[model samples]
Target: MATPNYGYEKRQKELAKKKKKEDKAREKAARKLNPSSPGLAQGDPETDVASLEHDAPTVPELPTKDG
Candidate 1:
């Protein structure tokens, strides 16, 4: 019969929590540094422009009399 290592498991859980917290802090710092990041849920100017261009309707050429 193997005994459960509760101490090791607790330490591992703590390390995971710490790592998650650190990663979240780093992400938040990055977002703060770059306000235009897509993660911020704000409209990006370049994205807006691209969407507008993509959605723009194309004009059809008229047939000329010589055609």
Candidate 2:
């Protein structure tokens, strides 16, 4: 079996963490540049506007014959 290199493993972990932090910063900057970019909203008007106006559906009444 090969011996473990504790120092090398620790450095590798630190490098990974640094890369992750840099990536998040870049993403935040990109979002700042495009504030109005199309994305998921709380609610979309075209698909949800009608449903919002109405509640429960009503059943049609049957007609009765008069004597």
Candidate 3:
């Protein structure tokens, strides 16, 4: 059998990591350029929930036996 090519494997891993980092940087830059983008707002769960709650119709509370 042939010997394993360690150098090639290492280079492949390094390239993958670099690509991931660059992609993340590019996404961050895009987000910065479009501050009002809907994608950005959806990132915050709390704010999204709050907005939904505000827009949702209110329901009347039922009376309890204690009252």
**Top TM-score prediction, candidate number:** 1
lDDT over C-alpha atoms for residue 56 of model 1: 63
Q: Tell me how far the alpha carbon of residue 41 in candidate 1 is from the true structure, in angstroms, after superposition.
A: 6.2
lDDT string, candidate 3, 13-36, tens digits: 999999999999999888667656
Local distance difference test, per candidate? 0.77, 0.71, 0.79
lDDT of 2 by residue, 1-67 (tens): 9999999999999999999999999987886566454652325554343455674667898887962
Q: Where is model 1 more than 4 Å wrong at Cα?
A: 41-67
What lDDT tens digits, residue by residue, belong to model 1 across residues 27-59? 978866776766544455544444555676779
Best by lDDT: 3
Question: How would you order the candidates by TM-score, starting with the best?
Answer: 1, 3, 2
TM match of model 1 to true structure? 0.57
| Error at 3, model 2, angstroms | 1.8
Please estimate how well model 2 matches the true structure, expressed as its whole-model Cα lDDT: 0.71
**Cα lDDT of model 3 overall?**
0.79
TM-score for each model: 0.57, 0.52, 0.56
lDDT of 1: 0.77
Q: Which ten residues in a row have the lowest lDDT in candidate 1?
A: 40-49
Candidate 3: RMSD to truth: 7.7
